[model samples]
Target: MSKAEKTRQLIIEKTADVFNSKGYAATSLSDITKITGLTKGSIYGNFDDKEEVVIAAFKFNAKRLRDSMDAAISKEETAYEQLMAMLNFYKTTWKKAASQGGCPMLNAATEADDHLLFLRDAVKDNFIAWQKKVSTIIEKGKAEGSFKVHLQTETYAYTFIMLIEGGILLSRTLNQITHLNTALDRVKLIIDQEIVN
Candidate 1:
């Protein structure tokens, strides 16, 4: 990458945690500079404004989370096992995410709902994309005989996403892992009793 490109990425990397943790509206220019140690001229030299930095940082965090989960899911031999792996992966990785300021997508979505209108569509698109991934997995499971045929892939996909995100929200807010575990447990139960043949 060019020097400017590398610097841009550096800024995003440094600011990701602050953006995810403190959020877009609340994160000030000083916060970005504090985390990144970049002068205002250098930051403005790379991006248009703090808005650009927040968006880039949020995307970086979301992509990192997605890549990690995708890597875990890819290790399983079957679609059923893959779904289970995802649940377990969440249980294992959530603490790390919480420490970094909870799920980036969840944090962005919550902030976008009432405050950051600029981020609303990006967060919406991310949710839609995630649901599509889950639906694709359910479809694969059906074809491979791991999941029951004729099940509503879209519905199951939506439920899984909802359960996971809801669980994260409650667990992070309540400072209790059981709420997240219970939500994940519910997802597994649904898969076992309803989705599996």
Candidate 2:
């Protein structure tokens, strides 16, 4: 990468965790500069402003997570295995997620509700993409005769997101990973009793 590009990436990588942990609205330009060890002019040289950096940082955080999930899911060949691969990834997600201050999408959603209006669209797109990702997996399962033909892909997908996000919230809030585990448990039951043929 070019020097400018590398600098921009450094800024994003360094600030992603702070933005995710401290919150989008709560994080300031000074925080970005501090974490990245870049001057204000240098940061603004790479990004338009704090809003632009927040968006970039959020995408960085989200991509890191999606890449990890993709890596785990890719190892499995069958649809059932693929779906289980996803669940298993989440089953142990609390550790990495907690260290980063919870799921990036969930964190962005909560913060964007009213505070960070600029991020509303970006956050919405991430969620829609996520819902679609899960739905696509369910569709693949159906095509392979592993999942029920009568199943509602979007519904299950949405529920999957809801359960997982809810679990993350409860787990983070209560400081107990079991809350997330219980939610994932329901997810497994749904896969077996509802989706599977």
Candidate 3:
């Protein structure tokens, strides 16, 4: 990568957590500067404005999460294992998520509503991608005879997403993992009884 590209990436990596933690509206240019250890001029030299930087940071955060999920899912052999892997990934990553200020999708979605239209769209796109990922896994499971053929894959996928994100919110707010764990447990039950053949 060129010097400018490297610098831009560095800024994004450094500020991603900040944005996730602080939200786009709450995260100021000064916060970016402080986190990145770059002068305002240097930041502006790379990003056209705060909005551009925020968009890039959101993308970076989303990709970081997606990559982690993909890696976790890839470790298991069966569709059931893959689904469990994903739920376990979230459960295991709770602390990490807390440290980063909760799930990026949840954070972005809550703050994006009536705040940043661009960010709202970005969050929407992320959820769409996520829903597709989960639905694909469920569909594969059905095709492979590991899951119930009559199961509505998309419904299950959306419900799982809703449960996970809502659990993250409650857990983060309470500073406890009980809600998140319960949500994951319910998800497991759904997979085992409702989906699994």
Candidate 4:
């Protein structure tokens, strides 16, 4: 890309962890400059303000998590297997998130509540997208006579998201992985009983 765009992306990539670890309000322009080795002029030249950079950095981190999940899910042969694979992926990857701040949706939702409309919208959209993906898999399973036709896909999708996100939050807060593992095991059990024929 162009030099300006490249610099902006570099800033986002470098500061993603900073924003996540420090939160938007606490992360300063100096932190961005320190991480990116870019001058204040270069940072301001590309982003309008700290808010803008925080939003972009959050999006960057969130996209990385989403892409990883997509890759893991795509490797499975069936919807049920895919769902299980996703939970397994979460169990393995979540430890790394401690250093990277935390789960993006959980971090954004807590920080953006009743403030930062753009960030709130982004988190909401991420949740909706995730639900839609789960629902699509459920529907596919139903069509293939794998999942029960009587199942409510939307509710199941929402519940699944809630469990996973809540699990992450609780596990992180408690500084224990067992909570996450238990939650994921429950998720796998639900998928097996509800989605597999």
Candidate 5:
């Protein structure tokens, strides 16, 4: 990468945690400068404005989440196992993430409601992509005869996304991981009994 691109990426990496923690409305350009140790001129040179930086930071955060889930899911042998692994991965890693101010999708959705169209569109796209991934796994499991063929894979995928995202929001709001665990437990049971053959 060019020097400017590298510097821009560095800024995004450093400020992503702050943006995730502080929310878009609450986070300022000064916060990015503080975290990145870059001058206002340098930061503005890389990004057009605070909105641009916020969008980039959110994309960085979303990529981290997607890559982590892909890694964890790729480790499993069976599609059923992969599905369970995806659900369990969230339950396991969510605590560490809670300290980072919770799921980026939820954070972006909450903060960008009715504002920041670009950021909200990005989060929505992420959710749609994730749901498609889950649906594909479910379809594979059915074809392999490891999952029930009668189940609605698309519906299941949507429900899985909703449950997990909703659980994260509830857990973060309540300041307790039990809500997350409960939601995940339900996810486990749903997969084990409804999907697994």
Candidate 6:
């Protein structure tokens, strides 16, 4: 990468957690410079404004979480197992997530829903992508006779995403795993009773 690109990336990496924790509206340019140790000129040299930095930071944070989920899902053999792995991912990574300021998508969606169109759209796209991934797995399971459910794959996919995101929100807010665990338990029960043959 070019020097400028590298510097921009460095800024994003350094400020991603701050953005995730404090949020876009609340995080100022000063916070960015303080966290990144970059002068205002250096930060503005890379990003046009705080919005750009916030967007970059959101993308960086989201990618980290997505990569972790993908890696865990990759280790499972069956489609059902893969879905379970995806669910278990949050459970396994919750502590790290809590430390990093909760799920980036959830944080962005909550904070930017009505204010930041770009970020709102980005979060929407992320949810759509996640739903599609789950639906694809369900379709594969159905095709392979692994799942014998008589339901809309999209519906199940949406439900799963909701449960997981809700679980994470409640868990993070309450500082307890029980909320997430209960959500996962519901997911498991649904998989066992409704999806699995």
Every candidate's lDDT: 0.90, 0.89, 0.91, 0.85, 0.89, 0.88
lDDT of 5 by residue, 48-103 (tens): 98889988899999999999999999999889889889988998998899999899
RMSD to native for every prediction?
1.0, 1.1, 1.2, 1.4, 1.3, 1.3
Candidate 3 regions exceeding 4 Å error are none
Which has the higher lDDT value, candidate number 4 or candidate number 6?
A: 6
Give a tens-digit lDDT track for model 6, residues 147-170. Answer: 985768999999988998899999
Tens digits of per-residue lDDT for model 1, 1-197: 99999999999998888898887889999888888888999999999987788778878888888899899999998889989989999999988889989999999998889988888888888888888888988999999988899998999999999999999999999999999999999999999999998
Residue pairs with backbone overlap in model 1: none
What is the alpha-carbon lDDT of model 3 when measured against the actual structure? 0.91
Q: Which ten residues in a row have the lowest lDDT in candidate 3?
A: 111-120
| Candidate no. 1 TM-score | 0.96
By summed lDDT, the worst window of 10 consecutive residues in model 5 runs over 110-119
- Ten-residue region with minimum lDDT total, candidate 2: 91-100
lDDT of 4: 0.85
Highest TM-score: give the candidate number: 1
Off by over 4 Å in 4: none
TM-score of each: 0.96, 0.96, 0.95, 0.94, 0.95, 0.95
Query: Which numbered prediction scores highest in lDDT against the true structure?
Result: 3
In model 4, the clashing pairs are: none
